[model samples]
Target chain A: MDIKAYIILSLALFTIGIVGVLVRRNAIIIFMCVELMLNAVNLLLVAFSKMHAMSGVAKASPYFASDAQVFVFFIMVVAAAEVSVGLAIIVMMYRNVHTVDVNFLNRLKN
Target chain B: MNLTTLVFILLSVMAIGSAIMMISSKSPVHSVLWLIVVFFAISGHYILLNAQFLAIVNIIVYAGAIMVLFLFVVMLMNLNAETEPVKNYRLQLVGVITGGALLLVLVSAVMKIDVEQLVEMKVGDQGLIKVLGMNLFKNYVLPFEISSVLFLSAMIGAVVIGKKDETANQ
Candidate 1:
């Protein structure tokens, strides 16, 4: 696989995700965008791992060898946990406010 | 025009298109469905990278479990397109500009990297299951052990937060 192409596509996805989170008023859409961003980063990390693996230095450097995949694994775990907690919070917010609009979440404002 | 490049092109297009659709769709349920498609496309990319285990886990966890939870939440909330609030035009413009700027910067930086040097690296043949299993069990065992604790905490947290408050007047 062309690592650069993967990197570029992932970057594009990440950018779109950022925009989605920023522009969208719906909380569910924002959560989806956050997932998109996380997936994008995971894509880049895997590409880097493959690139490093191809370089043969992965075996020499203990950190580079298996750590990349391990790191991705940890990231996946964290992302999963985050979604559970985050969606719960969103559900709570919606139940209380009856709206998922981000702009109306200004009840904390003085 | 090689197999890798061809696969990359196909998966990238599918992933990006579904991602865009996930965000842009007016219906929340439609967005969740599109997100599932995006997750599958990403798993395809993982497979192309030769991480078969990761790809399978990716599908099972993200596409199957996580997205199903999202769909349930949307349905339980009774969300519909008409109820969704519309964002102001100025914020929309700013978002598009910001996203475009970030994409330009990232692409330019990536373009500056030396691809030939990266390609010179020798690829390993240890498939996903073998290499990751050995490494996770061997050198990075501590993190592997800690992850269980993390998962336990997350489960508890989810239960606590998701529990309904019956005493509080609705």
Candidate 2:
């Protein structure tokens, strides 16, 4: 397993997600971009979990090797929750303003 | 060089390409579809890494549930046509520039890391559901239950926010 390659791939995906969040104005798309970022992190963590499992020091105990995988599960749970709340917020925004664009959400400004 | 490496490269290309298209696509629905492609590619990677459990969950949670949620919201908004508002070039340029800089910095840092004592992969069944379930239920039970609470709160919050107020209707 070329760990470097996995890391690079994960990083590239993360970068694409960053660009998506930065460039998009649509609230739903922006939320999707955040999900993309979360998936990227999940991929990297899985790769690291595999790497740790392969290392010699951790050969005896397999539990330490798979800890990151469990962490990824929690991340997925949090992401699911976030999606529900975020979509609801976007829905509420649409109901009040009649659009899902984030540009009109500058009411926090002075 | 080997088959696994080749497969990894192929999946990586698919993932990155779909991701780029997801952001650049003119329609939000298309973006969601592209994002699904990316998720599938990532799931393929998980399979390649021998993590079948995660790969399945990725498909079920992300592509099945979350993406359908996105599509439903888009459909509800009546944004079938290309209706996104146009923004100035400066904001986009700034976004692109920042993203590019972040990529460059992270990639360079990644390349500099030297792994002198890396071990060969054992191909153990660590990614299996049985092992992960035991670990999750035994050691990580608290976090798991707390996450359920988080989900409950999120469900309530979504319902509260999405429900139409009767006072505003009249």
Candidate 3:
């Protein structure tokens, strides 16, 4: 597949994620949008890795392509950890505030 | 178009459309479902790109564990379409415009790249588990081990934060 096509697709996904984060009032939804953006970047990284391995320089290094995949694996690990903590925070917020709205989190403003 | 390109287009459409639905859906449960669709599409892309290990991991981790966690939290809070908080339409419009502008700039920049490389698709062995496992256990072992510590900290932090305060009720 053309690398440009992959880039464009990833860009579209990332843009949707950004819009979701900006537009949604729900904190959980916003967090999910962050996950969307992370996945988009992960897709791009994988695409770039394949592209690099297809080129001439990768001949010297056997591990060049696998590096990106390994990085994506670690990213998933971190994302899992992040989601656990973030959802716990959100759950606590909902428990205290009784709503998932991000606007309600403005108590510090006062 | 060939089969690879066709599959690529299909997965891209599925991903983008599901992502749009995920954000636009009124119900949090529905949004989580749509996000699962997005994750599936992304995993399909991974498989097409011959990153088999990442593809499976994406499905198991994102679609299985993380999304289930999201659904559990959403359901536990009793969040639904009727209870969704309303934001200003003007703010939403502005956000859409801003995101669109960013997308435009990025797409334009990406188009300017002169290299027209083809991604190595189903033919590559670099995405195989054996290759990635060796690489992970070799030079990347330190980061991998440190991530375990991070997970430990995160688990403890979540437990600490979610615990009920005994004194506060008194």
Task: List DockQ, one per candidate, in order.
Answer: 0.59, 0.71, 0.89
The DockQ score of candidate 1 comes to 0.59
Per-residue C-alpha lDDT of model 3 across residues B1-170, encoded as one tens digit per residue: 89988998899999999999999999999999999999999999999988999999999999999999999999998889999997899999999999999999999999998978989989888899998988999989999999999999999999999999899989
Better of 1 and 3 by lDDT: 3
- C-alpha lDDT (0 to 100) for residue B107 of candidate 2: 90
Cα lDDT of candidate 1 equals 0.82
For candidate 3, what TM-score does chain B get against the true chain B?
Answer: 0.98
Top DockQ model: 3
- What TM-score do all the candidates reach, one by one? 0.92, 0.95, 0.98
**Reference-based lDDT, residue B38, model 3:** 98
For this target, which candidate reaches the highest TM-score against the unseen true structure?
Answer: 3
Q: Give the distance in Å from residue B92's predicted Cα in candidate 3 to where it truly belongs.
A: 0.9
Q: Chain A TM-score for each candidate, in the given order?
A: 0.89, 0.95, 0.95
lDDT per residue for candidate 1 within A11-83, as digits (tens), equals 9899989988988899989998999999899877877777777777637544454566677788889988888
Q: How far is candidate 2 from the true structure (C-alpha RMSD, Å)?
A: 1.6
Better by DockQ, candidate 3 or 1: 3
Query: Which model scores highest in lDDT?
Result: 3
- Error (Å) of candidate 3 at residue A30 is 0.5
- Arrange candidates, best DockQ first: 3, 2, 1
Q: Which pairs clash inside model 2?
A: none
